[model samples]
Target: MGTSLLILGVALWAGAHFFKRLAPEKRAEIGEAGKGAVAIALLISIVLMVIGYRMAEPVWLWIAPFWMVHVNNLLLFIAFYLFAVSGLKTNLHRRIRHPQLSGFKAWAVGHLLVVGTVQGLILFGGLLAWAVVSVIVINRANRDWARPPEAPMWKEGVAVVGALFLMLVVGQIHGWIGPWPFGGA
Candidate 1:
């Protein structure tokens, strides 16, 4: 049941997100109300994902070597930095068309390494797939890419510092609910 909920939640996430792009006419018909509907759907999806992940029984495939934790942490750090790049429109943002989606892929893959369970596979893999598919979908639909205005060099430094801080804070929060990521083997 938990796995089912998790799958359903992931499906809902994809559906809600893709609705705007896939059904522009319908979305336009709904007008401003569509935004609220999508937001509510996203919130429900998140709740289902959290509950499902917490409730699911672990079925381990293979325990990751302790050293992989460091690798995973590095990937997560990169992911966070890329996320910052996406928002800050740093230099990297021009090079990377979809930094946020790339970050999402990294984040999902990082988790996939440490979590060897079926539930982990489903959650992380599903999200990874979603990110990949989203990129393809977006690329196909939008041919022209307009780069955002160049940001000051200082903004890059800010992104770096902000990413580290974000990783620390989010890691701490994760520790409260689940496994402590910092130096935890």
Candidate 2:
């Protein structure tokens, strides 16, 4: 049941995301309404994924070494930094075309390194694939890439600090919900 829900969630999320790329005319037909529908679908899918992942039993495919946790933490830091930069008007944002998706890729890869369970593979691997495909499709859609206007450096600094705080909060939440990331393997 958990696996089923997970699969359904991934399918709904991916399908909704790819709908615009697959059928632009149809998407344009609905316009704002279509965007709302997609947003709702994404919300539902995320809820389902969270529930399914929590309920699913871990079936270990391979045991990750204790050292991998350190690597995962580093990757997660980079991922969060990228995610923060994506939302801000940073110089780095102008250079990195798809910072958010790239962050998602890093997040997925980091989790994959630490989590060797079937559910982890299904969730993270699926998201990794989606991010990769979305980046490719988005790049294709917007061929005329140009540099964005520069923003103040202080804003970027603030974003980085916020990202670090968020990472710490998330880590605490993860520990409360499941295995403590800083705990022994």
List the candidate 2 regions with Cα displacement exceeding 4 Å: none
Clashing residue pairs in candidate 2 are: none
Which number leads on lDDT?
1
Q: What's the TM-score of each model vs. the native?
A: 0.97, 0.92
Candidate 2 lDDT, 1-185, residue by residue in tens: 89889888888889999999989999999999998999999999999898888788889999998899989888888899999888886889998988889888999999999999999999999999999999889889989888779989997898789888988999999898888876573
Question: Best candidate per TM-score, number?
Answer: 1
Assess each prediction's global lDDT (C-alpha) against the native.
0.93, 0.89
Each prediction's total of clashing residue pairs, residues at least 3 apart in sequence or on different chains, is 0, 0
Q: Give lDDT tens digits, candidate 1, residues 1-185.
A: 89899998988998999999899999999999999999999999989888888888989998999998898999999999999999899998988999999999999999999999998998899989999999999999998999888889998999999999999999999999889897743
Residue 106 of model 1, lDDT score: 96
Error of 2 at 139 (Å): 1.1
* Candidate 1 displacement at residue 177 in angstroms: 0.8
Error of 2 at 175 (Å): 1.9
Lowest lDDT 10-residue stretch of candidate 1? 176-185
How far is 86's C-alpha from truth in model 2 (Å)? 1.2
